[model samples]
Target: MNRIFATSICVILATSAAAAEVELSFYGGVQSAPSSDVSIRDDDSIPDGDFSIAWEGRSLEAPPYYGIRATKWRSPEFGYGLDFTHNKVYPENDELPAGYDVLEFTDGLNTLTVNAYRRWSSAFGEVSPYIGGGVGVSVPYVEVANSDSETFSYQLTGPAATWIAGASYPINDQWSVFGEYKGTFSSNTADLDTGGTLETDIVTNAVNLGLSFNF
Candidate 1:
C-alpha cells in the first residue's frame, strides 16, 4: 500500500510539471461596454447587450464564457497556437410609440470563433503577449408579437471578423491569471415582413480575466 501511494504521488507531481509547458485554461468573467448601438429609429437608440449580458440584465450577474487553448513554448521568449470560443449577446425589449404595438425587440447574436497568436515573455513571471484574428458567423434569432396578431419568428446569420491582443501572468507552473481585449466586427441585413429592410453594423469590445492552467 505504501509503495502504491508513493507511485501515485510521483505521477501527480510529474503531470503538474508537464503542464507548466503545455497549458489548457478554463475561465469565466464579466465584460462591460461590449456592445453596439441599436437604432430602432432615427431618434431612438439603445446599447447592445453583448456576451457580457446574455443570461440576464440589471443584476450582479457575471457573464460566462469558456474557451480552450494550446501553447508550445519555442524559446523562453515566444510561442504560438490556436483557440476557440462560443459567445452570446443578450435580448432586450423596447416598445414602439402609440398606434404601434410591438411587444419586444428581443434579438440575440451568438457566434463561434477560431484564432491564432504569438507570445512574448519577460522575467517578471512571464507575460505571454499575442495578437491574432479570426472569422465568425453571427446568427440572430428574433421574436415579435402584437395585440391582435399571432407572434412572428425568424432568424438571420452572417459572417464576422475579430482581432484580439492580451497577456497572461504565471502564478505557478500550472496556474495563472490572464486578461484579453477582443474586438468583433459584423453586419446584418434583413427584410421585414412589414415591408422594407432592416440593416445594421455591429462592433463589440470585451475584456476577460480568469484562471488558466498550463498543461
Candidate 2:
C-alpha cells in the first residue's frame, strides 16, 4: 500500500508540469457512518463471531474531521488532484460482543486518493459546480482492546474510494470558498494483538465547507 501511494504521488507530480493552474484547499466538516457488520477471525480469548456495528462520527470532538486537497488544472473545465481526509468512527458499545472493551478508529480512518475532476461554469449563478471521484487506500489508526490483549497503531488496511459533488464561488482570482458533499467507502482488515484479525466495510458521508487558493 505504501508503494502504491508513493507511485501515485510521483504521477501527480509528473502531471503538474503541464497544468495551467494549481489550487490548494483546506476544509472542515461533519461526517457520519452507517451501521455495518464486523467479522472477527481466529482469536484466542474471544470466540469468532459476525456482529453488527452502529457507528458514531464525533466530528466536533477531540481530533475533528478535516481534509486537504491539491489540484492541478489542465484547463478551466478539467483537472485532477490528490486529496487527504481524516475521518473517524466509534462503535456504540451496546452493539459490541461481550468482553470487547474498546473498538474504534477515533484517531483516524485516513484516506489518500488521486482524483479526476470536472467543473462547470456558472452552474449556479456565480458558483461553479464540480464533481470528482477517486481510488486509494485506507491507513487507519486501529484501536482494539479486550481483557487479554490490546492493539493500538496505524495499519494499512485495504482499498478505499470516494466521490464528491460541490460548488465554489470565487472571492477573487486567487481565492474561493465552497461547500460540498462527499462519500467514501473503505474495506478494512486490521490485526489484533492476539494474532487475530477483524474486518469491516465502512461507508462514510460528509458535508463540508472550505476555502481554496489558486496559483
Candidate 3:
C-alpha cells in the first residue's frame, strides 16, 4: 500500500509536464471564533454520566491564524496544494459551579490543520480571481487553567474535519497577496476528557491575508 501511494505521487511529479511554476505562500490574519456548544459534567458516572452539552461557547475576541501553503499548478486553471494553518479561540465566560461565584478561568481551544486543496484561477489583466477548497483534519488542544484560583484541566488529541475558501491577486511575478476564509469543524463537543467532561466543538472561521512567492 505504501509503495503504491509513493508510486502515485512519483507519477504525479513526473507527469507534471504542463505544470506552471510552484507557488509557496505564507500568510497571517485574524479569525472570528465560530459559535460552539459546550458543557461540563460535574460528576463521574462512567460512560453514562449525562453526556450532554449545556453551554453555548463564543469568543470575546478574534484570535490569530497563520500558516504556509505550497501549490503546484498543473495548468493555468487547475492546481493542487498542501496547506497547513492554525486557528484558535479562547474561553470567554463560564457558568460557575453552584457555590462559587468566580472560576478565575483561563483556557482556550487551539487547532492546527494540514489540508490538501484543489484550486481554479482566472486572469483578468494583472489580477487573478480564484476559488478553491480543501478537506483536512484539525488537531485540537484544549487548555484548562490549573492554578491556585483555577482547579481543572483537559487534554484533547484527535483530528477533526476542516474546510477552506479564498481568493488572491498577483502584485508582480514573484509576489502576491490573498484573502481567504477557513472553517474547521470538530467532533469533540460530545465528549471531552477533562477534570470534568468539558464538551465543546472547536469550530473556527478565519479571514487571512498572506504573501506568496513563485519559484
Best lDDT among the predictions, by candidate number: 2
Candidate 1: tens digits of C-alpha lDDT, residues 46-141: 211212111222112332443444454555655444343334344333324333344222333333444445666754446767666777555444
Candidate 2 lDDT, 72-119, residue by residue in tens: 887878988988788989985445677788888888888888899999
Q: Each candidate: what lDDT?
A: 0.47, 0.85, 0.52
lDDT for position 72 in model 3: 81
Q: Give RMSD (Å) of candidate 3 vs. truth.
A: 8.0
Clashes of 3: 0
Worst 10 residues of 2 by lDDT: 1-10
What would you estimate as the lDDT of candidate 2?
Answer: 0.85
lDDT-based ranking: 2, 3, 1
Ranking by TM-score: 2, 3, 1
For residue 77, give model 3's deviation from the true position in Å: 2.2
Q: Which portions of model 2 show Cα errors greater than 4 Å?
A: 1-20, 93-95
Top candidate by TM-score? 2
